[model samples]
Every structure is written in C-alpha cells, then in structure tokens.
Target: MSFDKFKPKYKIHSETENYFKLRAEAGAKPYDQLTVEEAREGNIANAKRFAGTTEFEGTVKEFTVPSKQCSDGIPITVYRSKQCDLCVAPSVFVYFHGGGNVVGCRQTVDTICRIFSRDAPCVVVNVEYRLAPEHKWPANHEDAICVVRWVKMNKGLLGAVNRSTVGVGGDGEGSRMAALVCHEVPDLGYQVTCIFHASAA
Candidate 1:
C-alpha cells in the first residue's frame, strides 16, 4: 500500500505492545525525561532482556588504545570472522553506538558488531568514544575522525587492504557522526550503510 503522509497506518505488534506495557508497569520514564544514569541503564537492561541466553558465533580480540596510541585513547574491541586473520583481512569497519551519544557504549552494540564481523568476514572496530554532558560537542566528532584516521594509520596492523579500505559508520546519532567524519576527513575508505527509522505515533 502506498503510504499517506497525513494518514499513515501501522500496527504495534503484540510483543512490542507488551514490552512497552511492561515498561510502563515498571515505571520506566519517558525517553526525554530520563536521567543520564537511567538512560545508560536502560540501554544495557534492554539489550540483556531481549537477548537472554542467546549467543552468536564469532571471535573477538579486545584491547585499549591509550590516548597516545589512537584517537583520544579509546577502548576498542575488535571482532573477527571465524575465517579472518591478518592473512585473510582486507577491510575494517569502525562502528559507533546510538543512544544520542549519551547512553550507548561498546557493549550495547556488541551482538551486531560480532555478526557484522562474521558475515562481512572483516575486522569490526567497536569504538567507545567520549559521550556528551561530559565530553561536549565536537568531542564525539573529533573522536570519530581520530578513530577512522587511526585505522587508516594502522592499516598494516589491522590487516586492512590499505588506507582506502578503512570504513566508518554508526546507528542513529552515530550514523550522523559517520557522515560528519566523512565530510571532515575527505578520504575515509568505504562508509558502511546506515539506516534509520522513526514512528510518529
């Protein structure tokens, strides 16, 4: 059916309906009003609540890059495909999490990163950039730029094909950050596709 901007139609699935119902019963605050701590907690809690007991296949090598080593010295977790190694590596995707850049961290998007690494059969760099209400504006953007540059700068170690194979992306706010980085950096490899959606109801 063709969509009508003024008269859009959709249904809230029962499962989704129940989730919100449960949240209401538990006194979950509206998103706009949530305290920073509450917002952070909700991101983690929702991830666990939805993913209970489910495990996806992948391999991970994690490490912290001191500020001296990479952008802002962020904590980065590298997820790899089962078949991936320095010999098999050709590209790296740097990802950022949503949460308005206020709530999410590396862990919040762990599952997707693992899946991306495995399915793409490439290295996934999950970056934990400084958040707002703390780091301030341009800080996140700077971190994004620096991290992508770091990947390009360390392509030999990351097993990337070359500086041109270093890509960057994120969900929600992160996607916009990716675009900003692409705009500012001029030459960040391929940018991963980022899709977003919202409901007016």
Candidate 2:
C-alpha cells in the first residue's frame, strides 16, 4: 500500500504585502524629518538647561582663535580667569554653542561660558561652528574639530588652555558635534577628560 502526502499552500495577501512594503520604505530615522528651525529651537532649550546655577564673580580674559573666513569658519571666544591653576586643571573645556546647529553665536552663549570659566577656573573655549540649511552636517562638525585641534596643537600660542588636559563639550546639537570631534580627531592628541552634555539632542 502507498501513502499519499498532502501539501499545504497559502495565498499571498496583496494588502499585507503592501503594508509591509510601505513600512520598509518608511524605515528611515526620525531625525531625517526635523526642520532646521525646529532643531535650532531644541538646541536653545538645551542650552538654557546647561546654563544652570553656576555663577561668575571674577575677572575674565577674552581671546580669539584666528580664522581665515568669518562666515562659516571655526571661531573661538575664550574666557579665562586669573585665579585658574592651569598646570593642575588636567582639562580645558572647549565648548560648542547650542543653536540647534542654526542660529546661535559666541555672543549668545558668552555669559554661560564665562560662568563655566569662573567656576571651574579652567580655560573655556567657546566655539562658533556653522549653522544648518546653509552649513549643515559635517561642516559644523569639521569646524568644531578644527578649533579644538588647533588649540591643542598651539596651546602656548593660544595661552589660555591647558595643554595637558583638554575636554570637548557642548549642548544639544553642539554636544553632538563636540562628541564627533572628540571621537575622530586623534591628532588633537588631547584626551577627552569629561564631556558635559547638558541635555544633548
């Protein structure tokens, strides 16, 4: 006697297949949808959060990192305190401004940087990276890294930061940029002692 085997066949539902295809097509990351203005607003909110209870009641020295172009180049505003013991600080904080990568400047975050400078008494390098829509993605990241690397290379010329200890930090989009710089630019040859990301987006 021979036994017959039955095979089960299933129908392909067009609706289900279409639904899955649509989902796969929409699998992009959420950030891909954010507008420049929305990103900027988010960064500002993050900056406010980082500008915490720290206060400054001391003298500060203003210094700039030299640059070729001012439009979308990396510029730095340093706030230094006479009371700082740079030799022992073990880290200089290079701060990137928070403007959602769009509309903030060194002037906007001056007070906050000064406060950090006074409180920590370490060199505070406030970076002015390029904004979005005009200067997006790697532009901002490159600017931030360039400034930090330059400072690290010519610490004596800069005269404000401690060469021994250099830290890169920022808030929101700035924070994201700072992290990228820290991770990639090894030639800066500075260790990231601490990253102060005040509400990073």
Cα-based lDDT for every prediction? 0.71, 0.60
Q: Give the TM-score of each candidate.
A: 0.78, 0.59
- Candidate 1 achieves a global lDDT of 0.71
Per-residue lDDT of 118-178 in model 2, one digit per residue for the tens?
7666677887777777865777776776787777876654444444567777766677777
Q: Ten consecutive residues with minimal summed lDDT in candidate 1?
A: 1-10
* Candidate 1 deviant stretches above 4 angstroms: 1-8, 11-22, 51-58, 66-72, 85-88, 159-164, 193-201
Candidate topping lDDT = 1
**Tens digit of per-residue lDDT, candidate 1, span 1-201:** 112342346654667666656666666665577777877887777766654442445557766655642343777888766545534445788998877767778887888887777767678899888898887887788778777777777766654555336788888888888888888776666776566421110
